[model samples]
Target: MENKHPYSELGYKIFFKIKPFLKKILRIKVVGVENIPLEGGCIIAANHRSHFDPPVINIVSPRPVIFLAKKELFEVPVLGWFIKKAGTIPVRRDSRDTAVIKKSISLLKEGFVIGIFPEGSRARPGEFRKPQPGVGYLIEKAKVPVIPVLIEGTDKVLPVNSKFPKLFKYNIDVIVGKPIKFEGISSYEHIAEKVMHEIRKLKGERHG
Candidate 1:
């Protein structure tokens, strides 16, 4: 991936280096990692909660996961640099950014794993938000396998607008849902709904 910034990826390197510090604060237990592809272009569509979601996914997945972070987040000088270095794409939510789309597609073709938060935006108190359908489009267009990841207990660890994660060692479980068949899928909506169902079923209890 071509990143314009020198420090865009610095965060990833630094984050990984200091992750041991987080170990004491967070009890992150990931399961079914074998469900993810060892290599090749595969999509990881997961639920969004804390800022830690992307980092957590990268830590456990054997393959490198390219996260589609919001474009604005990368605008900051240092933050932008590291985001690009981490191979994350900047997406413009309201309007389609051709540059970002092209870059993401290119990365997938290169056999790199891509991560997307299908919820589009963070979840609220009401019903779960519907996916933007872009992921389904990518799934069919890229013709790659889709892996649904259900993240439970992240919100409890750190809710929206909370600067620091709770000090307590909360149980954060990640469930890698089975890869669903993509051959017969004709529409993006169909596939989007399918992925949501898989995540819902895979969401487990906070503990145990």
Candidate 2:
């Protein structure tokens, strides 16, 4: 069957082209990749520590992921062009944007995978920010499986205030946890907490 999902072939191609270079420059170790389902719509809810989080997840994902990016990134020049072409959805961080919610639901129905950082923004390394309710809303609305992921060591490569990454100097670890599906409960906050709990477990950290 012809693909109906909105994954950009050009984006996947670009990712593959740059994958080798990224790998050569940074030591990235991916664990429990099998936890990611091979097909269908799923949400990858992860912790964010650095700007590199998105690309790292995209590169390691078994399938193409449509990221929910902060709206500001979409206003930049070349970065904007790439993200738009890659079929990323822009979200305004200051409020709960219904338009983004609707768009995400529509995409999920079309069998697209979405990568979301529930913490909403980058937090200090080894610490997690409280997850936003949007993630739970998406899970409840779309009724898709969620995979909790923990990313480590990216902060060292690109610290919070640094503009450029320290090339070839850091080892990054991405740990993928088993999928969590909400069978009946629909409270957005509760669901978000559950997802965050799983991520914390993977990171070997206490719940926030």
Candidate 3:
């Protein structure tokens, strides 16, 4: 695997050491660290339970992840600095940013793990919906492996719009399924649905 992300060269100690303690302090248990590949670039499609999802994923995994986040997140000053330094790319939610797409492809080609949340929105409790097509776009364009990750009990741990996180112990389950591969998808949407199905299977019936 080649290093495509600029942050790929940076150390993982900060994210690795901090996440587990934070999770333990906050009581977020990770069960699938072994599921994440130790090397090479692959697309990790995880269920979005909260704003905490990205940080949680990075904290638990030993390998560095280059996340494709929405452009709006870049506005926060200190956070924006760290994300930029982390080899994260921002995409405009409303319009297609050719530059963002190109950069994602380049990073994938360079063998950096890129994460795409297929839901395209935050997770809602008692409900699961079809995934958005952006994930397929990346998979098809990059021709990489798609790792299906199921995030359970995250919504309960940190529900959307809670204002602040609770200190109570809550289980955050991460179930990683087998990688999915596609050959010459007719379109990006097709690739996305195919990937979403694999994720759905892994995410069946979330329990806290």
Candidate 4:
């Protein structure tokens, strides 16, 4: 198999090394780490509320995650370089790009974890955006377990229009639900709905 995400190895290693500091700073509380399989390809579908969502999820995830980042992020000077080295896939929002889909499926088949925010972009804090069909398509084609993750407090950490992230003041919780499998479920939109439903359930539990 070709190593498309070559920087993942080094990038993840660095993340692991700094995890302690991040934990101390962010007060990240992660639940359901055991739900993630020890190996194999899987999809992690999470809600997006802040730009910090990706790194927060990445740090807590047991394996290196190949996230589908916005294409513009790859054009950023230093940040782009870092994300690319971290093996994030660049995607054009609101565009019908088959190449991105094919690459995701292929990566899943190769047993790499793919991280996705089905909302397609960050949602306003305390707001819910319906999951798009792209994630459903990937789940249907990959034939792998789909992990539903709910991240709370990131929106406050670095809210929309905020230039800097507030540190050491919020408790970020990452709740990873059981892996959901769909069989004979053909509707991509339906699959995306089911995934969001699970995420909402996680949200309920957090407050309940």
Candidate 5:
């Protein structure tokens, strides 16, 4: 399956225009953004806590990022238009969507950055969910660097069951961890664990 909506100049243009407003409203503080490579295909594995996660990454990232969103989001009214224009790929959860996999591979090979929430679903505050294996599979298959990202306070900004964000009421932090290379790693689950471990460290959580 070919990617119908690849990364576009328009997306970046729109993002740059709205970035300042978003940062002010969310009080977003980004750290370790320099850890992101200047050029290359890489996977950003992040912990999901709120819908704001994707926008935070897009605004803070040094490069353009394409994320795999659930198929349902693409059916919405205005959101569907924006996500599609931003080059988001629609994925069917809990199943092997061959089209998504193929499209991801194609984008990676073309030196595009991909963002993935390994948790597979948003977790509540003070909760940690085990990561799904799909991110690991992509890491192993893409054979690219994986950067672990930790997002904090988005849950408070826009928690589950809430439509509008509190806006300027909370501070959000996006911490980017060092990239992990999967050159000789063979186990997808192990690689996924390692990625999650880094995210935990960024969140100041202990992991053994």
Candidate 6:
């Protein structure tokens, strides 16, 4: 079957080429990977703590997952170029831009995996931010299953204010929860809150 995702084959090719190196450097351990559906549209909602979060998820996912990045990141030099070529969707943080949302919904309908950070931006280590309503809105509109994920130790790999990422010494763990399909009518904020609740449950289990 023809791939419906907007990302070029070259992106996946490049990823395959370097995935081994990334796996070795990041030392990522994955759990509940089977929770991820083998095919069809779904949202991989995870907490954000580092710029490496997106790549880390992509490295572990069975299918290519596209992410939404801040519009400002696209203007950066090398990082911006790489993300753009990787087919990330840029979203304006300050204003209400429907284009990005529409594009995301379209992608979901196309049966592609879309990755999102409910908190919207990176938080300090051990800190949890309230999720933005955008993720909830997307779920309501797209009516797709959401795979809640919990990621740990990425912040240590690239702590805030550090110019470069640590090549080693940090072990990253990603826990993928069961897919959730919301059925009732609810506000976007409520949906986002519910998703975050699921993510937190994963954290609680990890520590319990």
Best by lDDT: 6
Off-target runs (Cα >4 Å) in candidate 1 are: 1-24, 76-78, 125-127, 204-208
Instruction: Give the Cα lDDT of each candidate.
Output: 0.76, 0.86, 0.74, 0.87, 0.85, 0.88
Between candidates 1 and 2, the one scoring higher on lDDT is 2
Model 4 per-residue lDDT tens digits across residues 61-142: 8788889989998997887888888888889886867899898888888888899999998888878798999888878878
TM-scores, all models, native as reference: 0.83, 0.90, 0.85, 0.93, 0.91, 0.93
Model 6 RMSD, rounded to 1 decimal? 2.3
- Residue pairs with clashing backbones, model 4: none
What's model 4's lDDT at 24?
76
lDDT of 1 by residue, 75-119 (tens): 877767767778677788888666766777777788878898888
lDDT of 2: 0.86
Residue 2 error for model 6, in Å?
Answer: 12
Among residues 3 or more apart in sequence or in different chains, the pairs in candidate 1 whose N, CA or C atoms overlap within 3 Å are 7-81, 7-82, 8-81, 8-82, 8-83, 9-81, 9-82
Task: Provide the global lDDT of candidate 1 against the true structure.
Answer: 0.76
TM-score (C-alpha, index-matched) for candidate 5? 0.91
**What is the C-alpha lDDT profile of model 2 across 55-85, one tens digit per residue?**
8887788788889999999888887888887
Off by over 4 Å in 2: 1-7, 17-21, 184-186, 205-208
Off by over 4 Å in 5: 1-5, 205-208
Model 2, total clashes: 0
Give the Cα-based TM-score of candidate 4 against the true structure. Answer: 0.93
Q: At residue 208, what lDDT does model 4 achieve?
A: 19
Full ranking by lDDT: 6, 4, 2, 5, 1, 3
**Minimal lDDT window, size 10, model 2:** 2-11
Instruction: Flag the better candidate by TM-score, 5 or 6.
Output: 6
* lDDT, candidate 6, at 77: 93
Scored against the true structure, residue 204 in model 3 reaches a CA lDDT of: 64
